[model samples]
Structure formats: C-alpha cells, structure tokens
Target: MLLCDVVTTSASVAATRSRLAKVEAIAGLLRRAGDQVGTVVSYLAGAPAQGRIGAGWRTLVGLSVPPAQEPTLTVAAVDTTLGEVAVTSGKGSAARRTTLLEGLFGAATADEQRFLLRLLTGELRQGALEGVMLDAIAAAGDDTVGKQEVRRAFMLSGRLADTATAALTGGAAALAGFGLTLGRPIRPMLASPGESLAEALAMGECVVEYKLDGARIQVHKDGDDVHVYTRTLREITGAVPELVDLVRALDCRTAVLDGETLALDDGGRPRPFQETMSRFGATVERELPLHPYFFDCVHLDGTDLVDAPLRERNAALHRAVGDALVIPGVLAPTGEQAEQVLADALERGHEGVVVKDLDSAYQAGRRGKAWRKIKPVHTLDLVVLAAEWGHGRRTGYLSNLHLGARDPDGGPPVMVGKTFKGLTDELLAWQTTEFPTHETHRDDWAVHLRPRLVVEIALDGVQVSTRYPGGVALRFARVVRYRPDKQPADADTIDAVRALLPGAEAAGRG
Candidate 1:
C-alpha cells in the first residue's frame, strides 16, 4: 500500500470525535494492510516501528524539501529507509542521515510530509492509543477473535504489533497460545489510590503491604541466566549488575519476581527518590548499590502463578526469597490495624501501604480496583504544559510550571493549576536546559511544551474553579519529583483530581 493511504486514514481518525468511527477507519485500513501489518500498526499508534533512532526535533526541523506532485512512496519502502537512517553511525554519519531524510521527504506528497514530520518528532496528536487499536484489531478479525482474548495476548506478549499479526494471520486460537516465558517480560500490574484506610478495608479481607518509594522492577532468573526489566519492559541487565547477582543467588532455578528496588543509606533507611533515580538512569558508573525487596512472584519453579490468587502468590514469594527480603505485610487487618500499618510504614520512611484483595488474581497491565494505595499525603502525576521565565534571584531560568491532567476520553490534557515550589537549584538548571527541547511554541513570558514530561505533585486538596476547563483547581500545590519512569498517558485523569473535592464522595456514591 502507498504511504498516502495510511496518512489519509490517520487524518480521518484525528478529525472525528466518535471513537466508533475511529475504530471503523482503523479496522478498514488493517484489512487492507496484507504484509505491512507491523508498520501500519506502529504508525497508526503514533510511533515508529524502528523505535527511537537518535533523531530529535533539533535535527529534523532544519531541513527543507519540495513536495512530490504524485504519490509514489510505498509503506515498505519508507520503513526500509528509516531502518537505514537508524543504523547509520560514527564519523560523517550526520551529513549522510540528513541527505537520506531530504531525499525521502522530497519524494513524499504535502500531506505525507506532514505525517512524516509529526511521526519523526514524536508529536503525532492522533486520538488512537494502544487500547483503541486493540479494539480495531479485533474488529478486523471479522468476529473470529474476541476483544478480551486480544487484550490478554497483548498483555502477555508486551507488543501490540506481534499480537495484531497473530490475530490477523492465525486467528483467535493462535493468539490464545501466548503464555508467560521465563526470560521474556510481561506487563506489570498497577494500583489505584484509595480515599482512606477504612474505605480500603470496606472491600473485605485484604493483604496490606508497604508501598516503597522506589523504581518498579521485574526480575527473571533461569539457572545461570538472569535478566532485569523496568515497568515499561526496557532491559537494563548491564546497568544493574548488582541486581543480576542478587537474583542469581535465589533458590529457584527459573522464576519471575515483581517488586521495588532502591538505594539505602548507612542507617538502613531509604534514600531520597531523586538519589535512587540518579543511579537507575546511569549506565557507565556504579556509584550507588541498589537493594531489592520481593513482594509477589508471578512465576517460580517452572510454574506460572499469574492465574493463582494473591494468597498463593505471596506464599510462593516467601518460599522463593525468604523472610529477609520479603516485604512486611499483615493478613486481613481491621481498620485500626490498617492505620497502624500505614503509621509503621511512614515511621520507617516508606511511602504507604497497598491494600490488595486476598482472592484477586494478578491482572497484568490493567489498573483495576482490586488493589488500592493509601499515602500520608495526596499526590498527583501531572503533565508540564508550559513554563515561565524565572524572576529576581532565579533570573534566566524556566521557573514556574503550568500543569494539566490527562483526559479520560482520549482528548488533550485539561489545565488544572501552576506551581514553582519544591524546586532545587539542580532541578531549575535541568529544566532550563530540557524544557526548550520539547517546545512547541514560545512567547515573551512563557514557552509552551508538547505535554510530554510527567511530574509528581503534592497538593493540599481540590476546589471548584471557573478558570480552568475541568471545573477544578489544585490547592497549595508543590512539586515532589519528576517521574522519568512514566509516560504522558500514565498521568492521572481530570476526574481523579476532582475526586478530592469536599462533597465528591456523596456525589460519587449517589
């Protein structure tokens, strides 16, 4: 198929507000994409099949090319050319990459050029994400495949491209054949925030575990081979050699453990989140050693525990890691007991406690209500929409941040409030250097960004407001830390922010 056809379908998908219409358009395109299923799926979801290729906005915006009078570029041809551009490296590679991009863009039509520019710069604003694309993939199966089956296959495989290909070529039965492997990583389960400890216990018997303020990791061990992956499934085995050695010391031959990893101080307490992240993102040096605490085991001793209940999984975790590394927890605690658990966690310099349903199975990649997190203070993950220039002693820096919450209906983020608090000198210097790289437009006072950076913010509460489109604003907001582990899609929704309103509980239950 021609690149213009895919570009035209993407335009139609972005123009319509109805999700059903978007799904229908994508399903029709998927039916037509015979051998280019991988490329088509990746482009429709606003990403490249080749992944990040060291290309940035600074490199692409400098080239100018004339448009072709006719559409002659094929999808496979573009994919191959991008693969070439990605692999080009070393001396004099920059000039060669620019020449290659110029030739490709010059051959594309005007609309095709727009699509390519957006796709390369990671600014494709189409409303279709992986969730909507999964629905479209099922729709293209002509009722031979179910939506839930496709979702499960996607969660296990950790790749939408592979799941779509399986459903398209081998039907539903082939898609159902996907299972947990020892070395491969599956999507990790997530949690939702509860209003209070009493409310969390109201759900019935539960297991409350301390929520550590650290990076989420999934460790897989098979005999002498060990691999570690982040929550987003990026392998960091080489950077974290200490963790590799630690997992190899376990008793089980093959296992998959889900938990948190952090660096500790001399007093055996957790360090600041920024200090831990500094070590997490480093690749060359080994300055800080990280420690792991196992909470749940998904696979152990050649058996998959994903289908088992939480009680069974915890037992497996204890047998695998023993009492020294197991997270502290209590079973079926009362309201007062749960409060005491939270207090103990805070006293030990931990985040909070996660109340989990005792009989609930591990729902990978889905943020269901089976698990709820309770923290001492309320915090929200919000996007940076814009930043204003600093004043006085902070002159010549990007100081104040305009924050927005994600829209639940797949729309753009809604503005909530702004904050300049909780920023250190290092953070201020880093923002001044990094904010302009994501700049979409600029003015005299502030420079607007692409809403890509996610930051965790601590707030007092929420109040009714007519200034913002969400009808709510944050009270006494301040920054806690920047979340490089999370994406913009992972930000809290506008409705989640409004749930902190004074009378929101009564309105919610009614």
Candidate 2:
C-alpha cells in the first residue's frame, strides 16, 4: 500500500472525535493494508516497527533534502528503510544514518515527508487512542471476531501490531493461536486507583494486599530458563538475576508469576522509590540487589489460571511459590477489617493497600474495579509557577501546571514538578480565565505567572530526582482544589516536600 494512503487515513482518524467514525476510518485502512497491515497499524499507533531508531528532531532538522512532488513511497519500503536506519551505528555512523535518512526523505513527496517526520520523531501519537484502533481491527473482521476477543489476544500478546495482523487476516481463528506462552511476556493486570478504604470495601467482597512501593514484575519460568519482565513488558532478565534464581528454584516446571520487586534498607523496610527503580535497568547492581515477592500466579506446572477466580489463583500462587514469598494479604475482609489492613501496610512503611474482588478473573492490561489501590492522599499547598497550553482535546485550555514549594529561606519558591491530572472542565475553564490575571510573562508554550496563587495539590509521594530544583519530584501529582484561602507563604516548604521522600521518618507512608 502507498505510504500516502496510510498517512491520509491516520489524519482522517485523528480529525474525528466520534469513536465510531475513528473506528470506521481505521477499519477502512486495515482493509486496504494487505500484507503491510502490521506496519500500518504500528505507524498509526505512533510507534515504528523498528522501535526508537536513534533519530530525533535535532538530527533531522539539519537535513536539507528537497521534497519530491509525486507520491511513490510504499509502506513496506518505509518500514524497511526505518529498520535499516535503526541498526546503523559505530564509527562515522552519524553521517551514514544522515545519508540514509536524507535518501528516504528526498524520495518522499512533501505531504509524505511531513508524515514521515511525525512518524520518525515520535510526535504522531495515536496510541493513547488505542481503544478505537482495537475496535477498528475487530470491525474490519466483518463481525467474525468480537471486540473482547481482540482485546484478550492483544493483552496476551502485548503487541498491537500482531493483534492487528491476526484480527484482519484469519479473523478469530488467527487470534485463537494467541495464548499463555512461556518466555513471552503478556501485559500485566493493572489496578484502578481507589478513593478510600470504605468506598473500595463497598465495591464487593475482596482481598486486601499491602501495596508495596516497588516495580511490577512478571516472571516466566520454563524449566531452568527464567525471564523477568517489567510492567511494560521489557525483559530485565540479566539485570535481575536474583529474580531469575528465585523463580528457577520454584518446584513448578513452568510458571508465570505476577508480582513486585524492590531493594531494601538495613531495617528491612523497602528502600526509596528511586533506589528500587535503579535495579530495573540494563546494568546489574550488587549493592542494590532486588528482592522478589510473587503475588499472582498466571500459569503453574501446565495449569493455566488466567481465567480462574482470584481465590483459585491465590491457591495456585501459594502452591507454586510457597507462602513465604507470596505478598501478605487477607481474603474477604469486612470494611473495618480492611481499614486495619491499610493501617498495617502504612505502619510497615509500605505505600498503601490494594482491595481486590475475590471472584474476579485476572483481567490483564485492563484497569477496572476488580483490583483497587487505596493509597494515602499526600496533599501540598503549592504555588502555581506557570501553565502550559494544552493540546488535542484540551487545545484551548491552559492545562499542565508548573508547581513550586515555598523556599524556607524566602529567596523564591523552588520548582518541584508539573501535572495536568484530575482537572475537570470547570477547572480548566477557571484556569483559562483566572491565570491571565496573575500573568507576569508569556511564551509560545506556557504563560508564566506571579507566584501569588497557591493551589492545593495531591501526590502519591516524592522521589529523589535531579530534574527539579528541589532535588525531589512529586509522583502522580494532581489538582485537589485551588486553595484560594492560602497565600504563597502558606504553601508547603521545600523542606516539607523533601521530607516526603521515602525512607524519611516524616515521610508518613501510612
């Protein structure tokens, strides 16, 4: 298929706000994709099949290649070129890559060049609109394949490109081949953020597990060959040999265990969030060894428990990994009892608790009410430093807020973090109207404001970070409400923000 056709179809998909219209447009593209269906889907999903080719705006901006007048590049050809560009490296590799990019860009028409730039630089992001694309893949199946089946297949495979090809090709039959496979990482099940213990307990009869502040890991063991994957499905098998060794020692011949791994302090409390994250990279650290704690067993000794109830899965988990390694939790607790569990988790220096419905099956890659995370809401009265103009659906709104904590010495507020989360339409409208009144300066990206307005912000916690002037950054911060009653002087101090870092006595995990 011509690259121009796919590009135009992507534009059509992006131009529409209606879900049905987006699905139909993508379905049409899928129908016409033929053998290049995978490549087309990946591109529209704003990911290259080659994945993160060492090219960026700085590398491409200098290219002076003239655009071709007529459309002639094919999707397959572009994919092949990008694949080649990704692997080009070593001595004088920069020039070699530029030559290749220039050749590819030189052949493309002006419109195709624009699309290629968007595709290469990682700007054309439609993956966030992935639900519509999944629907489109099912729709293109001519009613032979159901939406749930497609989603299941995608979740199991952890690759939308593969899902697209399967759904568009042999319909349900192709997707049926996708199942629990050892060594291949499936997307791990995610927990929905819970409001409070009482509210979460009201959802259903549930098990509450201590939500440890650690990295999510999915361990697969096929005989001696054990692989550990992150929540995003990247294998860190080599970096975390302790995890591999621990899983290999399991009595089961083959198993897929979902859990969290973290580094620990001398007191046996979990280490800071950054220290734990450090173990997730390519390099193994002897000083920062990661300890594994398995929670859910997906497959064990050839028995697939993915479709089983949580009660059955927990039994399987205990049978496979033993109770010593399993995450501590209570099954089917009352509301008051669940609150006790949350308090216990907090007192132990853990993040919070996750209330999981006992009867719900493991819904991989989906965040629903099956499992709900109840963490402490850490709020800070932070001064609004600036606001970035929004994009896409939030185009006209002043969306992302730059937050600062009051410097105790009183020089200036220290910039801590930025967040656009939890803002309602009413809040966005209010920001647009109210922010300009406090404006000190303006830039193309954001409107700078006088540090007079104090906004109440809720965060998961603070982590050690060099990105902020305060040497700490807010994790998962969102607007609680505007603290119009408070002044900048009344805002939380930078010392207060730093004290929230995990491992500090004043951090208050509970």
Q: Which stretches of candidate 2 lie over 4 Å from their true place?
A: 126-128, 282-285, 378-510
TM-score of each candidate? 0.96, 0.76
Candidate 2 residue lDDT tens string, 1-510: 999998788777666546677788888889999989999889887778988988766787677789989899999889888888899989988888898899999989988888888777655643225566788889888577999889989988888899999998888988988999998898778776665788788877878999987878899999999998887688889888888888898888989999988888888789866577667764735568888888899899998888899989999999999988988788888777878888888888887999888798888756677898887877778999999999999999999999999764333578999999989898899899999977768999999986778887888899999998889999999997775434565577787788777776434444
Model 1 ranges with Cα > 4 A deviation: none
Task: Give per-residue CA lDDT, model 1, range 1-510, as digits (tens).
Answer: 999999999989888868898899998999899889878988988888998766667778877899999999999988988998999999988888888888889989999999999898888867777677999999987567989888878878988888888888878988989999888899888899888887888887899989999888999999989999988898888889999998999888889999989899998789988777777667787989999888889999989998899999999999998988888778888777888888988998998999999898887767677899999799999999999999998899999999999876456789999999999999999999999988999999998999899999999999999999999999999999999888888899898999999999889899
- After aligning candidate 2 to the native by TM-score, how far in Å is the CA of 352 from where it should be? 1.4
lDDT of 2 at 470: 88
